[model samples]
Every structure is written in C-alpha cells, then in structure tokens.
Target: RFMDSAKRLPNKPMVVFEGQEWTFAQMHEWSNHLAHFWIAQGIGHGDIVCQMLENSPDFIANWIALMKIGATAAFINFRLPPKALAHCLRIATARTLVFHPAFAATVDAVRADLGAATDTAPACPPWATLVDGAVWRVHPATPPPPSRTAAVDFADPAMLIYTSGTTGLPKAAIVSHMRMTLAAVGFPGMYGVSESDIIHCTLPLYHASAALIGFAQACFLGSTVVLSRRFSVSRFWAEVRESRATVVQYIGELCRYLLQASASAAAAATTDHRVRIAIGSGLRPDIWEAFKRQCGIPEIGEFYASTEGTAYLFHWHRAGAPGAGAVGYFGPLARVMNGIKVLRVDPDTHEMVVDSQTGYGQVAAPGEPGEMISRITNEPHKRFNGYFGDASASEKKVLANVFSDGDRWFRTGDLISVSADGYYYFHDRLGDTFRWKGENVSTTEVQEAFEGMPGLVEANVYGVALPGTDGRAGCAALQWAPGHPPPDADARRQLAATLRQRLPPYAVPVFLRYVPQLEHTATLKQTKVALRHQGADPRVCADPLFVYDAGARTYVPLSAERYVAL
Candidate 1:
C-alpha cells in the first residue's frame, strides 16, 4: 500500500504535526523508526501497547509502529481522572506506553497504582524522558520480517478498545485485525477520500472517531493528514487555509463548537476557497444546516460505527445533506434496520409488549423515534467484540427472542427511528450518556472536580429534568465533611476557575445543590436519582444551591424566580 501511494504520488504531502512536516517518505520512515523501537524492546506480535496521549504526531507514529509489527494498540483517553485512567491501564496489560511529557504529574500519580504493567511501562515519561533514553539509539538495522511459523493471522485480536463509559465502569471491546482492516478501507472509500485530499485531524487520538478509524482512513487513501495539539475552534480555519486541506475529520460537537466560536463567521469567510469535505459522526439534526452554512463546507460524509458490532452507517449520497440519517457508506454490513421491533404480552397477563399490527413498540413510526436493534449474523468482516464478556451489561442492551423466537441481537441503548424510505432518523438515546451542546457530557468528569476542592470532600453530579430539553440539565450535589471549609464566595471562585480550565463550559454543572447529607444506595453509592428529582429546587436544602448566572458569568444562589425559564 505504501509503495503504491509513494510511487504514484510521492511528492504529495503526507502529514503536518505540531510544526513539522512529514511527506510520504518522512511518514513512512517515522513509522519504521517506531517499529524499530518496538522490535529493539522485544515487543513483537500479540503484545499490546497502551497509548495515553492526545492526538499528536507522536501518537500517530507510535500507533503506526504497532500496526507494522502486528501488535495490538489500546488507546486510552487522556482526559480521564487518575482513578479511572489507572483502572483502564490495568486491563490493557500493555508493556509500553507512548504519552505526552506534559502529563508527568498525572502519570506519576498513578505510577504506583499500575500493578503488573509497572515493569512494562518504563519509569521514564514521554518525550523529554524517552528522548535521552538508550532506546533512542538507532537500531542496528530493520530486522527481517518474522517467520509465518507463528500463525499470526489477520483474524487475530489486534486491538482492545473500551467505550466512553459516561455512566458506570467502561466495558472493553475486542476487535480483530481483519475486521479493522476492512473498516480502514471502508472509511476512505465510503467518504471518497483520495491521494489528493489533505485532511485535518483535531479530535483526540484516544477516541475511536479520531485516531483509530480516522487515521486508518487517511492511510488507506494515502492522503496527507494535518494534526493539531487539540481542537481549537479559533484556529480551525486558519490551519485549514494554511494547509490548503480538502477535508476535515470531525465529530459533530467539534463542528458545533466551530459554529459557536466567536470568530466562526470571519474565519470561515477568510477561507472561502478551501476545504470541500467533512467526514465524521454525531452531527445532530437541529444544527445540521446552520453548521454547513457557517463552515462554508459543501460535502458531509458521516458514519455511525459502534466499537464492538461490525455494522455501521454512512451518509454519502447527499453531498449537501450531512448527518440527517444513518451513515450511508464506510462499510457494507452497516445498514439501517427497517422497523421498530417490539414484543407484546396479554394486557392482564403482561407477559411482554405485544407484536401485533404495531409489530412490537417501535417508536411512533419509521420516521419517529424507536429502539434501534442491529442483527448480529456474525459476518466475516463483521465480528461482535462483545463487551469483554460482560454478560449482564451486554444483555442489558440486547433484546432477546424478539421478532423470531430464537434470534439474538445487539440493542443499542439508543432510541432511533427509520423513515418510510428506510432512512434511519435520530430519536432519543437511552443510556447514561446524554448530549449537551453536541458533546457527550460525562457526569463522572463533572463530579471529580469538586472532590478535590478545598471546601468539599464528596460530590454527586447528575442530570436533572428540564423543559424542552433533550436528556437533562447538569446538576451537582455536595456535602462537606465536618473539618472541611464550607463553600463560600472564594471557594466558589476557585471552583469556577478549576472547571473552566479542565472542562468545556457546557460540561460544567449548571446547578449546584448543597445539603447536610446525600442519599445513598445499598452499596453506598451516591444515589443521584433522588438528587435528580430535587433538581435545582431551592427548597431541596436550606444551605445553598448554585446556578450558572449568565449575566454575571458566575454561579449565584438559586431562587424560584431564577428557575422560571428552566
């Protein structure tokens, strides 16, 4: 693949990372260097290397190195809190980690916690630490290809990725090499990516949307990639203009943020002649048209791909119409299920939901919202990388013995509806995750902020009811340990400062509830259900509750009149 692209279009730009440029030759060399780094360390086939860095040139280099060696790579999100991050690294059982040097403190915090992999992960941090290590020495020479004697089939497990568990513990998804290779080719062809295209990659490397699949598509087409340290709405168009990029890899919320940025209009106007395509997922119906208008983009290639299941959907037919239905391209098995499949039981007997003319409750209609269940026929290119064998958790999302007596399928904890024309439409999503301003707002991330505030010891963050809202509004409930200081004005200031720096504004809790105590589950879990009911109720407690004050740009005491518009 590299030789064909290199020979056919050797001079075309391949990658621009940080401030450095990597043409086809350079990127190929870098990938080879990383592969050599792996071999010198004796990390060969069947080994897993954990990646905890954001999307950067190094991240891609390391990932490509693993791919070349036939080793598995587990990409872990860098935004995870210390505890959550440690838990994932433990499961990865990776012998090496390539990360950013800036996160030294975070890495150090969990260094001792990594039980088995401690020896696997060098005590040295990334970049600054590894740059001087003896491992940096040039390899004697690229070793000869390993013998086929080991039976390293493409069907072997090559990657183990976990879902972005916004609710509880994240479940791991195991994907095979064959499935991934097919997926890689599926994306570029589905989206019409070609050697001439220069794609922008701003999403985090750890995410499935950005690194795993996005990078795959770029390489598959032998297209050039432009990388950024992080997603910066202000700098998006500037970079696009700079690189003369033809396409951008995006997740819908990133587009929304670009639309929301103060300079969106001006920046977009500045680049009237550049950027023709956008390929990504999560573009919502409400903001679809406005997003296209503001960005001056003509074509949108969106795909819906689940981590485990082989099925996916892409939107390729309509150049101007982006993200209004199921993904239309990217792979063959990815298809839209026809109707709402529900079950029926006798009203008195109440055995199950009756499958009559209604054919089990499938939302309002094909166009209306309904449960989206995908068939698991176990196609060759498609495999069910079940949730690491989490039987109950996996079962919870699947509706068994439906439609037919003995058929089993995966039930996306999401509610989707297919149109009369067989186009799938967005309904409601039924899971711990809820979309806010187009971004997946993790409650765990929100609550973790208050856990370390000087005035607080524990916090319970969850979504609350709001009129004319999609899922819920963010609310944080807090309790002060006796010795800790109370949440006063200064503490509120500190709280606000920390959140804005660590999290996006939308993910920040809108309402804060302070109570003498909090409700708990039998396992002593903070029962957010009761708190969710209490909402921003000023009467929930006499202590204090904080609601974001739009006018003041800071949270203020909650009041009855204040919630009128809520």
Candidate 2:
C-alpha cells in the first residue's frame, strides 16, 4: 500500500516518528527489508509474531513487514510481566518475537519461562545472531529486487488483535487487511482527509483504530503526519503548530488530558489553531463541551469502535447527540439498523421483549435503549477469524438463531439506541472489560492476581468515571478480616512488594482502600460501583486511598499533591 501510494506521490510525508520524518517511499523500502528477512528466517503465514514495544516508528515498520509475509502479528502489552508474556506468546504459537533493543532484558527474563512452547520451533529469531557484527563494514540489506505481486485479498488476516477483557482472559480478535483498508479509504471519504491535510498522531501503534488505521490511511491517502513518542496535552497544540497540522487525532482520555492539563489555556481565544478538528472515542459527556469551548476547536468528531466487532459509527455528524460510543470497524453494507430487527434480549435467553408501557411485541424502536448487535453470521462482508486458537472464545461471541433457526449474529456486548432518523446513540457497556490507556483491563483477572497476598481478603473493583479521564480507573476496596490490621509496617511493605511482583504495574490499583468490612449485594458479591463513584473523597469513605509511587516503587497515601503528579 505504501509503495503504491508513494508511486502516486513520492514526496508525501508518510511518517514522522520521534521527530524523524520518513516519506512514503522510504517507509515502503524499510518495510520490505524487514518483512523479507523475517520470512527468510522461517517465519511463515498463520504464525504470530509478538511485539512488546512502545509507540515508535519501528513499530509501524515491523507491522507492515509482518503483513508482507502473511503472518499474524500480536501486539503484547509492554507492561506485561514475563509470565503473562510467555502465556500469550505460547498460546498464539508466535513464531518470531521481533522487539526493540530496549527489551533485551525483558526477553532474558522470559526466555526460560517461554518453555510453554516447548515442542514448537523458535517463534522469534534473535536479531544479533541473524547478522554478524561488522556494522561499519557491511551496509544495511537492500530491498528485494522487484517481484511479482497481486491485490491484497480483503479477507486475508492482516492482524491478530488481543484485547484484555474485564473478565476471563485476553481474547485475540483477527482483523483482516480489508478491515484496515476500508477504514483508511472510507475515513477520508466520510470526513475528508487530503494531501493538504496534516494530522498529528500520538496514539500507540499497537492500538488498531488509532495507530494502524490512522497510519495506513495517512500513507494511502497522501496525508502528512506528525508523530510523537506519546500524548502530552502540554505539548499537543504546540506540536500541531510546529508540524503545521490542520487536524489532531486522539483517544478518549487524550483530549481530557489536554483539557485538564491547562483549563485556562484551553479557554484562551484562538481560532487560528493548527488543529481545526480532532477525532477519537470516549469524549466524556460532561467534559465534551467544556473541552471544545476551551480549546476553540470547532469540531470534535468522535468515533466508536472495538477490536472484535465489525461496523463503525462515525458520530461526526451526530456530535453531542447524548450517545456516542461506536467504533468497531468500517465495512460495506454496514448500517445503524434504525428500523426493525435491532433489539435487546434477556441475558439468559435470546427472546425479545415487548414495550413496558404498552404490550407491543416488536424489536426496540428508535430512541429506545437496547443492546447493540449486528447480523453477520452468514454476512459475507464481515467474518470473524476466530480468536487465535481459542475456539470456545470464538463461539462465545456468536448469538445463534436469534431471529430464526441457523441465523447467527455477533454479540457486540454494547448497549445503544438508534434515533428515528437513523442516528445511533451509545448508552452503556455490558461486558466485564473496561478500557484504560487503549488497553482493556479484566477485573476478574486483576482480582485473581490480587489474591494469595498476605492480609488481603476479598478485593472489589469497578471502573469509576474520573473527573478528567476516559475509561474507568480501577478503584478497589480491600477488606482486612477482623484483627488482621497489618501487624507492622514491615508486613505492609511486603504486601505492596508482592502485588508489584505478581501483577503489571498499571493493573495495580491507584487507590489502596482499606476497611474492616466491605459491602456487597444479597448474593454476597462485593459491590464496588458506589465506592468507585466516590473515588478518594476524604469526607466520604475516608479509607485512605493510595497511589503506587513509581519512584519509591511503593504504595503511598493518595494526596492531592501526589495525585497531580500521578
């Protein structure tokens, strides 16, 4: 795709990673070199290559390289410990682990634990071993001599996307090249991106909708991009101006981060901003208007999409419509299905219900809240490639025979309502998973990880809407069982150390809430919704919320001064 686009306009900027710019032609060549070499090292199609990397130019280069070999690429969470990394890689049967030099120690930590793939051949080839050291004498390998090629069949699996569920474990969703291409080609047509348009990209490359989709689109559509190592609201607008960007792209909390970074600055008058439009999901209802007003951004076009599902809802036209959570994927024949056939049903059973006010037996009408589902079991346009090797998970996503026998559908697990005039509105979510930092956090998985720790009883966790954050921050209330108040500070410190060792740092709760007793429902399931809503209010449940201080690398009292730093 990059080569074809470059041939059309070789001068167009294809990437700007870490302040370094690469034209379309250069990106394509680098991708070709990486792809051919990996394939030559015995990596084959259908194999997974795990990359534990941060946002960088190399990440984009590696992804395209993997695609050239028709191999599945898995983007592992950089925060994952050695054990979790081994489990995911082994499960996917990853053939090659192409990673940056920064993670040499991470690879060392997991090398022995990688025995999970004992009988299988090597999945990741060591780079240094592949090339002998005489760097000064040898030149970088040249791109392959011109070879024959054909159009990328839309159905080919371009990526195997893994999402951390709020429950169970991470499920790998297969996205086709078609899915990536459609978003690139369709986004511009739908919202207008051109050669003259300069977009600022700071999202991590692993995120499907943001990095891959946006990166591919910019290259294919002849748009210039200004890349940053990570999102910094303090420097966001400034970067846009420096890059002469006309539009800025973002995710849910990124915009909020900008808004909260400096409210007074956002409120300053400036219509001549390098950014005329910004796009992303999770623009909070409460902060949406104020953020736009303060930033002087005329448009805040938000999109809603998930890794597994097909179809996308561009709330570009429906900005501020009270419901805007749709960002699955863009495909042909996709629609909001505002009329009949769109309905919500009992969780236990698929049977539809009638209106509560009137006994009218029919699917939900426009403006009525119902679970958002799509009819695509036999739909040729969107076919899920099954979660890696987990068939049970793949089957779990299907709603069989909803309308009639043998009619299969994909359960979106999202609640939404369509308007009478064909606009769809997001209501709420219905899965155990909640998003944070473009990654899904499984509450059950987190709770399980917290178990077995000394003095830690039952752990209750839920996503609470933070004042200036998208996705629920994991707020937990811990019970200390009678007479078990951490005998000494030594024990408390040990407890914190145990948690850090067992779980990823991000999975660690920001607020360490302690209490003698934790409230729960009649069924005895620990309830945390209210506690989460309250956050760390001192006047309310003053259980002494705490945050993990990375510098000290220990949990400390959640103080306002430190909260600002966190």
Candidate 3:
C-alpha cells in the first residue's frame, strides 16, 4: 500500500523535519538505497534488527528500509539505562544493531556486554553499525531490486515494540504487518484525514502512536508529517505554526504541561495556527474542555488501545460533547456488533467473580465499573498475537470459557464503566486501584481531582504501604505550576477543605509531597512505580512532606518525630 501511494503521489511532501521536506519519491529512493545496504549485510526475511536512534528522518527511513526487506525492527527506548538496554537486546536476539552517533556514549557503556557476536573480529560478522553518516553515505544512488514487501505475509511480524516496564523488565510486543497496515488506513478514516492535511507529530517515533498512527497514516493519505525530535511545551505551537500543520498529535501529559506554562509564554504562542484536529490518548477529563478551548482546537479524536490489545475504541467529538470524559462512544449498533463485556471481579484479588450455578463470570450492570474483556473470534485481525518470546505472559491475557463452554476472550486489564447511553469511560488500570478505609479508591480519579486545584501543575496519586495499616494509604506527589511558590499554610488549608467537600473522606489523600517536577516514561506517561516504592519516608525522599492534620483542619509539615507518630 505504501509503495502504491508513493507511485501515485511522487511529488507530494511526505515528511518535514528540521526545516527540510522530503517528497514521497525522495523518501522512497532513500529507503530503497538503505534496503539494498541492509540486504548486502546479510539481513534476510524474518531477521530482527534492533534500533536505538532518536526521532529523525533517518529513523523513519531505516524503518521503511527494514520493511522493504521483510525484516522486523525492534525499537528500543533510547532513555533506557545500560542494564535495561542489554536486557532488551538479549531478548530480541537480533544479529545486527543500528544506532545514531548522539547515543554513542550509551552504546559504548554496554558494548562489553553485547556478546562476541557483535564484536569486530575477522572470524565473526560485525553485529553493530553506526548509521549517522557512514552507512548511508556509501549506499548506491539507484533503487533496489523489485519490491519484496509485496510478497511478505500479513501475519508476519513487522516490528517488536517493548512495554514501559513499569512493573518489571520490559516485554516485547509482536506487531504484525496487518496491524500496521490497519492503523495506517483505519486512523485516516476515523479522523477524516485528507491529502492536504499536514500532521504535527512531537511524540517519539519509537512509540506506536507516532510510528504507526502518525507517520504511517500520513504516508497512506499522501499527506505531510512535521516531525520533532521530542515534545516541548515551549516550542510546540511555534513549530506547528511554522510547519502549517493542520493536525496535531499529543499525549495527556504534554497537554497538561502546556496548560501549566506561564501566561506570557502561552500568550506569545500562536493560537491561530491551522490545527483543526488534535488526536491522541490520555487526556484527563478535568482539562479536556479547557485544553481544547485554550488551544483553539475545533475537534478531538481520542482513542483507546494498547500495543498488545486486540480491541480498540475511537471517540470522535466533532459535534457537541456527547460522551464527556469517555475514551470512546458506543452507539446501539456498535454495542451489538462489538459484543464488549464488562465482567465483575474482586478488586483486591483481581480475580473474576463467577456464579456458582453457571460457573461463569457475571457481567457488570449498567453504570457499574468492571474489567472489560473483548471476545476473540477466528478472524486473523481480531486474534491476539501475544507477546514475543513470552508464552506464559501471553497465556495469562486469554480467558477460556468466559461466557460459554468454548468461548475465548482477551483481557484488557482495564476497568471501565458504561453509561446508560452506551458511552464508555475509563475508570483505572487493574492494578492501579487500591482499597483504603474499606473502600475502593482509583488513582486516576484522585489525580483528576487534583488537576482542578489551583497552583497545581501535575499530580501523581498512588497507594503506599504504611506500617500498622491494613491496606495501603493514599499519597499524592504534586508539582506546582511554573513560577509559583509552594503552598502556604492558608493555601494548604483551603486545598484540604476543598478536597474534603469534593471527595469522600476515604478517597481524600492522607499525605502530600511537593516537588518541582514529576518524572515520566519515554512515551510521556507519568510514572508511579518508583514513587510508590519510595513511600512517604522523609529520610528516603528528598521532597518536602506534609501530613493531614485532622485536628487543626490543615496540612502540617512532617518532622521525623511527626512521621513516626502517624
């Protein structure tokens, strides 16, 4: 499909990076040259090639070249430490690795542990090569032999994208060629993207959102994509205006950062840019309307899907808001055709609650939250491909005899509630929900409430283990808005009073920590694993700590003695 599109629209601009544009013909020729170079290096069909380059035109070209030669590209997160990088490379088992010069120090740090196969000995083939200016400089100027991508099977693995590894070491998810093709074609139809549209993509190319949805969709539609090395709140609008982008892609945190920037910075930013649609995931409900209104975006195309999940939901809000705070909308026809089920489960154990008589899981009633499980059929596209090189993890995601004797369903690991009008809203992740004061508490819900408070830029809510406590206690780490001082005594008292009135007593946070900034993963998702591990110990954490003072009706500083007394 990509090659056909390139042939049909050779002169159309396909990629714009760092003030340079590459037409479809130019991109095709460049990729063909690199494809011939890789074929010369003995890379064949079914072989995996690991990638650790930043977002650039070279990264996109290399990916296209690998696809042309029928090789799977394993995209490693560039920010990974040496230990984690080695683990990912070992799991991939790829014979060749390609990277840019900017990451030479990182590659050198792990060179000793890369094994003998990657060494430069004459007896063994070279396993690692730098693609900055040397490899592409030597490639032939002509196109490669007739296209080999056409002969590739749809079910064949095209890429290996690893998870965020929040719980443990990252697991490689197998993305098939058919799935990539579907994202390229399906997303354009979902947003009504046209050939004249120019998409501004600031997300990292290593993520599926930027690679498959942003880049691939532009290619499929014969449109233009404005690429950035990474997302920057300061330069986002400026770049969009300069590139004349009609569509912008974003993650939730990126939008929050934009909202938290100084009014002067935002005032200087271009709001009259040609951005008609903004599309991505992770937009919180509290700031959804505010972000659109502030940025002058007319439409929002929010979608819900993971790298490994088989089911997907696309919410198009071109008209007035029908499904507020919903990841997607399900019409009467969609509800019947998709057959999505929300099954009740034990929140603490995360096990399905089964009926004794029927011996099957019971579905949740309307307006009740439950774990969503989508039925899988014999169709190839709907089949869950499972994780790469990990059968045990893959089998854990499949539930057998879910509704009937031989029925199979794919567990989404997400808790969602459906309204009476068929709108689906995300509640929280399966493990992120915790029990506090004999009631269930959702971290996302708490985080959303925190976003509405004044002077708070970002909030990360998590349950932390406490001594002499039956369950985990709620702790919130907050980042103040830029140029604003930390909360004072009166400000803290007001915040506590507001939260008490807005939320249940059990759901209200018990402890608060103030920091200048919050850490995030490479894909721009706020991380909580490390914060949860650190707990609320002042000796372990460098951030300022505060304890809720029920008697004083305000938050007080936590001294060493005060921490132990609680």
What would the TM-score be for candidate 2 when compared with the true structure? 0.69
Instruction: Using TM-score, give the best candidate's number.
Output: 3
Q: lDDT per prediction? A: 0.64, 0.63, 0.84
Which lDDT tens digits does candidate 1 get at residues 1-566? 55356556656666788667877665566666777778777888888888777667677767766767778788776766788788777767788766676676777788778743333235554322363235644753332264511556766766777777655556667777767677778778777777677888887666566655566666667778888887776687788788788888777557655665523266435346578878887675555666676677777777766777644666763554433546442221333232223222222222345456845432344455444556666565444557654766666655556666666666665555555555655433444334566555656557645544654546777778777776567877787867776767766776777877777888888888877787642112345655666677665546587887756667777787777756
TM-score of each: 0.71, 0.69, 0.94
lDDT of 2 by residue, 11-86 (tens): 6677776667888777776777776666566765666788767777677777877776666678876655566666
Which of 1 and 2 is the better model by TM-score? 1
Residue range with the least summed lDDT across 10 consecutive positions in model 2: 128-137
Q: Residue 536's C-alpha lDDT in candidate 2?
A: 65
Q: What would you estimate as the lDDT of candidate 1?
A: 0.64
The residue-by-residue lDDT of candidate 3 on 1-566, one tens digit each, is 66777899998889999999898888888888888888888886888999898988888888888888889999989899888998888888898878776676787778779762453523223544445445565887566555556567889988999988877788898999888888888888998888889999999888899988898887678889999988887788989999999999988778777766634465547476889998998887887887787777889888888887777888887748677567878888888788578889899988899999999999998889999888887576577888889999899999888779998888988998888888788899988998998999999888877766777777889999888987788999998877888889999999899888877889888889998889877886778898899999887888999988889988888777888887
**lDDT ranking from best to worst?**
3, 1, 2
Comparing 1 with 2 on lDDT, the higher-scoring candidate is 1
Best by lDDT: 3
Q: What pairs collide in candidate 3?
A: none
